[model samples]
Target: MARDDRAVGVSSFEGQATSAGQASLAGEATGTASASGPHFAAGPPAETGEPLRHPPHGEGDERAGEVSAGGRGRPSRAPPSLSWLLFSRLVFPGIFLASGLAGLLTLREIVAPPLDMPRILSGLERGGSARAEALTQVHEAILDPRYRDLKADPELAESLIRVLETELRQPITGSPEFTVAYRAQLCRLVRELDTPRTVPVLLIAVECRIADTPQLDSPIRRAAAEGVVTALERHGPDCVRSVPGGVAALCRAAKDPVAPVRAAAAAALGHIGGDEVCDLLREMLHDDTDVVRYNAAIALAYAGRGTGLDTLHEFLRSENVRNLADTGSTESVIGDRTCKLLCRALFALDRLCDRSTEERLAVLHPAMEDLCLSRAPEEVRTLAMRVDLKIERFHR
Candidate 1:
C-alpha cells in the first residue's frame, strides 16, 4: 500500500491514504519509471499483481514529461537563439533613431538662414530684388568670424553704400512695407560703415527727391534725409569724420529747409569745423526756426568763434533755467526748447574760447559759476558741472 504524495498521486489502495504512508512508500521504491526505477510519488498500485508504475518524466518525453505540482502535464517552449535576441533588441531602437535623424535634418533646412555669406552679400551688392530684406539676413553673416576680411575692408563698406544709394534713387514699385525695408537697410548700412565715403551719399540722400511724388508720399526723399542725419549722429571713426567734404556738405545741409536736417547739420558742423563753417553758423543764426538758430549759436560758440557769446551768455545766466526747477512747463515747446538751449549753451561754454573771445568769456564766468551752483534740470545740471570743471581747469 502507498499514500498520495504532492496531491498529484492519488492513493490506489485504501490502506495508502495517510501522509506517513506516502513518505514510507516513496522511500520503499527506488526505481519505478524504469522497469527497475523508483516510484517517488505517494500512491498505491492500481493492480494487485503487476509491478507498481509511474508516469515517465524525461526532458521531452510527451507521454509523461514535465508536470505541475498538482500532477497536470505542461508543454515545453524553446528559448530564442542569441542572434534573434540581438536582432529584436536593436531593430526597434534603430528604426526610432533613423526617424529622429531624418526629422532633425528636415527641420534644420527650415530654421537655418542661408550660410553662404559671400553669395548673399554679392547679390546685395548687385541690388537684387528686395535687397533690403536680404541684408537683414546677411547682417549676422557680416559679423560672423568667417567674414573677417569683408568687415575689415573699407572698400567693401563703400561698395555697399553705393549699392544702397542706387536702390534709394530707384522708384518704389513694391509694397510700402518693402519701401520701408529699403529705408531700414539704408540706415543700417550708414550706421555700420561710418566710413568717409558714406558721407557723400548721406549728403546726396538729404536732397534726394522723386520727380512726380508729392512731398508726403515721397519715400526716397524722406528716408534719404533721415539717413543722412542718422549717419552724422553716429560717433564713428575719424576716417569718416575727418573727410574734408563732409564739412562743406554739412554747412550746406545746415541751410536745409527741413529743421531736423538743419539741426543735425549744425551739430555736425560744430563737431567738425571748417574755415567756412563759422560763416554758415553765423548765417544759421538768422534762420526762422528757433531750434536751428539755437543749435547754430551753440556750434559757433563751441568752435571758439565767440559769435554766439551773447546768446550763450544769456542762456547761462537766464532765469529760464532757474524757472525750470519749479514748473512742469511754460509754453510746452518753448519750455522744452529752453531746456535744450541751456544744455547746449553749457556744452558750448565748456569749449576753450578763442583768443578773440577770451575777454567776453572771462567776464561771464562768474555769472555762469553762480548758475552752475543752483538747482536745474538733470541734463542742464550735468552739463553745467562739466562746464565748471573746464573753467577750473582753464584758470589753473
Candidate 2:
C-alpha cells in the first residue's frame, strides 16, 4: 500500500464527488476541478508510476499553507510599499554614503597631522615644489602668534641654519627660476629669525656663486646680506664676535662684486667699532656705486670715525641733494634715494659734530647750510635744519 505524503480530504461539488487528492494545487478544486470531471494530484500525472510527493517542511510550500488558511487559491506576493521601496533604493544608500564620507574625514585627520619644524625641514630637504611649499608654511607659521617665537627655538634655529648651509654648499638642480626663488625664500626666513647663530650661514650666502650661470649676482646672496645686518643690529657686537672669521666674512662681502651685497655688508659693519672696520668703510667709500658709498659713509660714522664726515658733507651738497629732486618728484626711486641719502648724511653729520673739533664742523657746516638753501624735499630740508641748529649750538 502506498502512503499519502499530503493530507487527503473529500468534498461534494454540485452532486459530484471531488477528491482533494485529485487536484494538483491547494485550491485547484474550487472551480476548475468542479467544471472538469477529475484532476491529477499535485505531484505528477496519474499515468506515471512514480508516487505523489509533497515538498518538505520549511520549503516554498509554506505560502501554500497560508493561502489555504485564508480559504483562497495561492496569491502573488504583495508589492513592496512605495515608502519602503524608496528607502531601500535611495534613502538607505544616501545615508550609507554620508557615513562613509564622515569616516574617511576622521581617518584623514588621524593619518595626516599638523605641520611642525621637523616635518617642514624634511620637505625642504627634498627640494623642488616641496621646498617651496614648506617655505610657504613657514611664512604662515611666522604670522601665527603661537609660533611667532620660532627663532627662540634653538633646535629649530640650528636646523634652519643647516638647511641654508647645505643649499649654499651644493649647486642646486631643477628649474633655475624655481631654485632661485626657493633659495631666496629660505634665506629670507633665516634672516627673519634674527638669531645671532645664523651669522655664519648668512656669510656663506653673501659669497655664494653658481657655476655656469650668467650674472653670478644671486638674489639669495642679497637677502642673506640683509639678514646679516638684522642679526648684527639685534644682537649687537657680541653676535659677530661669536662666529669664527666673522669680521673676515664681512670684509669678503664688502669686496663682493655685487653692489647691494657690499652695501649691506658695509651697513652690518657699522654695529662694531674697530680701526679695521673703519678702514673697510674707507675703502668702500671709493666704490663706484653711490648706494655703497653712502652705506660706507654711514657705517664709518657708526664706528665714530670722522673720516666719513667729508663724504657725508659731499652727500649733502646742493647739486647731489637737489639733482634727483629737480628731475623727478620724491615719489620716484631716484628722488627717494637722494632724499634718504641726504637725511642719513645730516643725521650722521650731527653725530660726528658732537664734541668734534672745529676742523670737522667747519667742513660739515657749509654743506648743511647749502642743503637747507637748496631745492631739496621737505624732509631733507627739515633734517638739514635740525643739523644746522645743532651745529649753531656749538658756535654759541
Candidate 3:
C-alpha cells in the first residue's frame, strides 16, 4: 500500500511540472510575460509594471541591451563631471566678468582723462588720422582743469611742445583737420601763457611756420601770426634764429602789400638783430608808402644796425629843400624831426661801423658840427654835443 502511494505522489508532481511549462510557453507566444524571473508566472507583474516584449531575430532588445553610449538615448540621473560643470557654468561667466571689468576701467580712463604725456606723445608721433584724434583729445585735456596745472611744470610744457613739434614734422598725409587742430592748439597755448619758458617753444613753432599749411583758413593763419609776434616780443632776437624758417618768412612778409603785414615784419626784424635783417630794413626805407617807410626807420633805429643812416639823411635833406620851396612850416618842422632821427642814426652808425677811427670821424664830423651850430632845439644841441664827445674820445 505504501509503494502505491509513492507512485501516485510522483505522478502528481510530474503533472504539475508539465502544466507550468505549458503555461510559460503560452505566455511567451502571446507576448504577455512579466520578465521578473527566469520563468513566466501568472502574478501581479513586475515592479516596473510592464509586460515583456521579445524582439524579432536580428533585432536588438531595446530595453535590455540598448545603451546610451554617447548620451543620445536616455536621460541620466548622475551629475556631470566637476570639470565639465565648471566649464559650463563658471568659465564663460568668469570671462565675461573679466571683460566687463576691463571695459569699465577703459571707460573710466576715457571719462576722467589723465595727463599720460608719454602716451600722448606716442600718439602724436604716429601722425595719422589717429594722431589727429589724439591731438584733439590732448588739446581738450589741456583745457580741462586737471591738465591745466601741467602748464606750471616746465618739463611737462617742454615735453608737450616737443610732441607738437614732432607731429608737425611727421609726414602724415590725410585730411586737413589735423593740421587745423594743431595750429589752433598751439595758438591758444601761446596766447594764454607769457612765460619765458614758453618763449623758446613758441619761437620754434613760429620759425618752422608749422602752422602755415596749405589748408590753413584765414583766421587760423592770423592767430598763428599773432602768436609769432608775441614770441618775438617776449624773447627778442635770440629766439628768432632758434625758430627754423622764421627770418625768411618775416623777410617775405616785408614785401607783402598789406601795410600791417609789412609793419609787423619790420617790428619782427627789429627784434631780430642781424646783418640780413638790416638789409631788409634798408629796402623798406624806400617803400612808396610813408607808413611802411616810417615803420622801417623806427625798426632800423631800434635794431641799431645803422645801415639806414645814409638813406634817412638823403630823405631829410630832400624834405628840407622842398620845405624851403613851398614855404610850408609843417614841412620844415617835419624836416627838423627827420634831421634829429638822421643825427641819431649817424651816431649809431658811427659806433657800429667797422671802419678805422679816422674814417668814422670824417663821416660824423659834419653832422655833429651842423647840429651844434644850428638853431635846433636845446635837446638837439645837447644830443649833438654828446655825440661829438663820443666821437672825439673814440678817435683818441
Which candidate leads the pack in lDDT? 2
lDDT of every model, 2 decimals: 0.62, 0.73, 0.59
Better of 1 and 2 by lDDT: 2
Candidate 1 lDDT tens digits, 94-158: 98899999999877645655466565567677665646555765576566555445554575576
Error of model 3, residue 295, in angstroms:
4.9
Cα deviation of 106, candidate 1, in Å: 32
Residue 274 CA displacement from its true place in model 2, Å = 1.3
Report model 3's TM-score to 2 decimal places.
0.34
> What is the alpha-carbon RMSD of candidate 2 to the true structure?
19.9
**Alpha carbon deviation, residue 395, candidate 3 (Å):** 27
**Which pairs in model 1 have colliding backbones?**
3-42, 30-38, 31-37, 31-38, 32-37, 32-38
- In angstroms, how far off is 140's CA in candidate 3? 8.7
Global lDDT for candidate 3? 0.59
Candidate 3, residues 280-311, lDDT tens digits: the string is 79889888876467557656756655555554
